[model samples]
Target: MKTQNLTVKAVSRGLTLALSTMCIAITSACANFSGIHDDRQMSTPEHYTSSQSLPAERGHWPSADWADQFGDSQLSALIAEALGGSPTLEQARARVAAAEAFSETATAKTLPHIDADNALTRTQYSANALVPPPYAGSWQTENRGLLSASFDLDLWGKNREALKASVSQTEAARADAEMVRLTLTEAIARTYNRLALQFVLHDMAEREVRNREAINAIESRRVASGLDTEVQHKLAQTRLSASKSKLVGLDGSIRATRYQLASLMGEGPDRGLSIARPALGMGNDIRLPDNLPADLVSRRPDIVAARWRVVSLAHEVKVAKAEFYPDINLSAAVGLDVLGLGRLLTAASRTASMGAAIHLPIFDAGALRAQLKGRYAEYDGAVARYNQTLLTALGQVATQIAELRTTDVQLNDARDAQNATRQANHLASLQFQTGIANQLTVLDADLNTLAAEASVADLEMRRRDRQIQLAAALGGGFVDASVAHPRNTPAAVAAR
Candidate 1:
């Protein structure tokens, strides 16, 4: 065998992207990048005590089993089903799994890697080349085997920063999944409450239909006896028709709410048929925690996810900056090349090489700078989204609380009006039986009672729905234990 055929040549060292010393010199003389720096910083939010919204209190943050607090087993079961089967939630989980995979790859980049490679092939040597013997003009079988090992030195912390960015991204994905869960549960609860309200109103609609029928029948008899005109009878008939139409609308509404509830659960329309009427009790004990706006960062999943994105992008900015420096790596390889398979196992065929390599972006015509700028832009966008989500979350909580308070007062008034109307209708009936009041007066009183009852039902549903909204605004029982920048409020940063 010839010398060239007996050994293998390996490129194990040198600065990457620079083939020779001349290339490095040329690249060094090409561009000046001292001004390319990312100086944008993330914003710190203002932290306030719980007294900003309400007085400081303990045992107010929603618990994991907050759904059960509504005192409805069916609602709990439905929420459980939705959590387990929701396609939206499943997509969120898939994103988390992908993030975890990326994290694994990033972590692997920081560690040493070793692998074995082997190959068997037949090749014809060139007859007029550097080869000197019988193998020069003949086809020969060659066997090759090698083992390689490599590790990055991470001198500029590029790999380390990349790993951190991956980990932060994974955390953000996980928090996003939690946000989906919170949203899904809240939607199901709200839809269920709507269904219940429709049922209550449906009953009222039916009652009005019956009352109209009675009035229409009385008007028919009065017209036939020449005691009332056709106009009066037709007006009563029109009222009866209108009441029946209302029942039709309410029946459709009940069905529509059921369909909406089922869709929210990620199920077919038929699944709505299995849903029973809601028997939910108000979760009056649920309230804001003592450590609010300060602690809220760790409670709301959207806010937490947004903050994690900011953190991840911040690390990416570091990684981009590190890219402007050199990447140092160590590599080693041992291999044997022999024309005869039997000689592959012999010591004469053994070959080995080891060296360190450096990869530096000496010249790319501003590619590195562009990458760094892009990373900073992404980081800034994440910061903006985090701040916006924080503002929106606090606003939602406050709005729900205010709306619930108003509903409470309105509910009380509605019940009072309902009671008074019932009394008035009862007194009107008594007067009619004693001939002190006309039938029209009694009928008017009954109509007023129906209207008052319907208003009370509507308000009651509003109150319950608002309570659910408040619970949802309170993070729907989801709390992140891993608080990012919990101590880095504006005040703390200013003090620092």
Candidate 2:
């Protein structure tokens, strides 16, 4: 877009006109119109608190490169793929582009506008018109060309305020895109974690089945030798069948989760089945800071987006208020007016005019007032949403922290139980070999050990799940660099 700077005199004249119009409108409505409220509905707590044990160390704000902390190269690659290719993220980027274009449009309004015009026509005068009968019945050819320029002096700073509102909207759109990126990364990590857990469970089920087969073998030998009842052998066979069934179910789960992971990475569903499974229990442990920063709430993208919305609507309210004044427009034109094309360029055929126009809203059926009222309501709604987003972010972080701590306690207990069961099983095996324990007692010890192993594995999965949730709750290390420089997140980067 082309742009031209405004002069001091033009600016001053526009401002004077705007102020005088606003004065008249305001004074006339003094008895009927009430002023707008300055207070807002949302407030924030200075600090976050929990009803459980204090953390040994407080968590720090996540870094922009937070996904790397997971320590899984495959996961990092997957996240990058999703960020670069996901359709949802693409839509967000498109919205940012649209907002940027709108901002440019608003910016253009504050600058000078110029146009080149030209026209040629042949016409016959009407006989019954005011023109003399001799010329009235004659045909005439006319040629015209003109260069026109106009500018809306931002009187009352209305146009400038409109530009500000557009800028705020652009910022909001960018924050929204960042939010989508963060969410996509978190989803990929969770799905990958679940896929790994499914593999662990599948392995566990296989081992359980082998254990049941061994038990069945022992029971069959005992029954054939008349040392155990037929009922005992049948029970062992039933246990073996149950273990096999569980293994089958776990296989199906693994396949389903793999498909989900593939979709998250922006690939075909079957692509997940071919993906290499990352090793379990390899994720980096994110430590909580001893004291959470109050400003950490601002790190959340949705909160930032909501805040921008409030700013945009606040500007919109000003724009609406400015509408109460007259629209002051300055336009000028210089062109040649001639009867033939050959004379169009002659200096003597030139015509020129320059003037300014004022459109006062003497009567608009209260339309301007209604528009201003709507803008105010929108501004209030935006404020409330921003407040709600901040509160939700705080609550999520708090809940995740508490759950992480509880998981640690439960994991410790599970490990202890596994150790005890292992020792007990070893003693029972030794006693049976030495004829001090019955076969049923030895079998019971083995079963208990198997159960204990499964319990430990399940707890480990839960612990991993908690860690994932905590990372997401903490914004997963996303940073909004675009807030400082809109060009930082270029369309080219998003397109890639």
Candidate 3:
């Protein structure tokens, strides 16, 4: 037993010596991938700080339940239904699953692997064959079983970097899923707002039709009494017909808007038929985050996802660089090899072997360098995409804020017009009752008041819709925990 132990230790030392010798001899024989240079770069948040359009004060970030700020229960319910059933969200989730699978596979590749294998064969030996003994012409069954293990040295961290890249991709996929959710919720809210505006307009159209009918009656009376010409009465009839036509158009718009709302909810036109007029309110004025531009990078899912891609591709560049170096692997097998089934598991059939191998490309015709450059190009592209997303996200927020500010001014103006028309109509009615004004004047005032009311309602809905857009532009409250402590940035990884 002591001698066997010594023999095992001797073999181990020999293998170690041989492996060290080979590593020293060939370590300098690696391909070169360092001469390549790229000119791509990422833009930092300071790039947007110069924009004077953004608010200059501290403010609030949107919450996950930002939609509730609208104070409309129906809008909230529609958003919830769309989230649960939308095929777009489902597809995004599926992509996340696939990315996770890829990450798992990458992690597995970096670990040791073991497998079992066995084989059996039956054959008859001829008398003239190489075999020589009493059983030279006898039938025989051969069997072998092996348990093998192998591991890559990974001295250059190729597998390690690959695993990290996959992890980053998985995180990016998660951010993408959040982006889809934000987009869907905003769509539902906007569609619902449209339905509301159409309803208000439709009601105004009905009122306008009534007012015109009254005018038509007054005009007929005026013509019968020879106080007005036939042309004037015909003009009243023409106005009545125009009002009816406008009502028809508004009714059609309401129906179409409802159908659009149902589709956004992942349902059919029939579902839209059951939907009631929206009662959404314009929430508080839009507020910028306490930390703008800089903090915007992580709050928006698209930017976060793009940033992650830059990180992942940076790791991929490292992996490709590692490929230019030599690969070393260690392998071992312990098994039984026997000429007959009876002795397959016996001590005499035992065998064990182990060895190390190194793979160095002597003449690859620039393949490794080409691959390295390709990886570098991909990394640069990822950085560009990240920069673009960041720029666009910041710009979108700025635009929405500006638009909302304008909407506030317009909304106030519409309300003022509505009030003025209401007062004018009230006076005209009083004058008609006191015999100072005709019915035509009062009905005309009523029609103008209805038109002004519709305009105000439309403006109010626009303000609400603008608020929804601002919420979406502000990332809809997406928060990536990984952003708090990122392992690498695009610039940092590129430097390596």
Q: Give Cα-based local distance difference scores for all models.
A: 0.79, 0.74, 0.85
lDDT, candidate 2, equals 0.74
Ranking of models by TM-score: 3, 1, 2
Instruction: Score residue 479 of candidate 2 by CA lDDT.
Output: 54
| Error of model 2, residue 86, in angstroms | 0.5
Of the candidates numbered 1 and 3, which has the greater lDDT value?
3
Model 2, 1-496: lDDT tens per residue?
Answer: 1232245456656766766676566646432224643445434435335323334364566665665665777877888878888888989999999999999999999999999988888989888888786678788888988999998755657898799889989989998998888888878877787777777778878887888888899899999999899999999999999999999998888888888877887789988888787665535665775544344445678877887787777777778767766667777788899976787777899887766666556567777777877877887788789777877777787777778778778878988999999999999999999999976677778778878887877777677777776777666675554433333222211111
Error of 1 at 135 (Å): 2.0
Candidate with best TM-score:
3
Model 1 ranges with Cα > 4 A deviation: 1-52, 55-59, 484-496
TM-score of 2: 0.85
RMSD to truth, every model: 5.1, 6.3, 2.3
The TM-score values for the models, in the order shown, are 0.89, 0.85, 0.93
For model 1, how many clashes?
0
Write model 1 residue lDDT over 111-220, tens digit each, in one string: 99999999899988999998878888889998989999999877668888799788888989999999889888888888888888788888888888888888888899
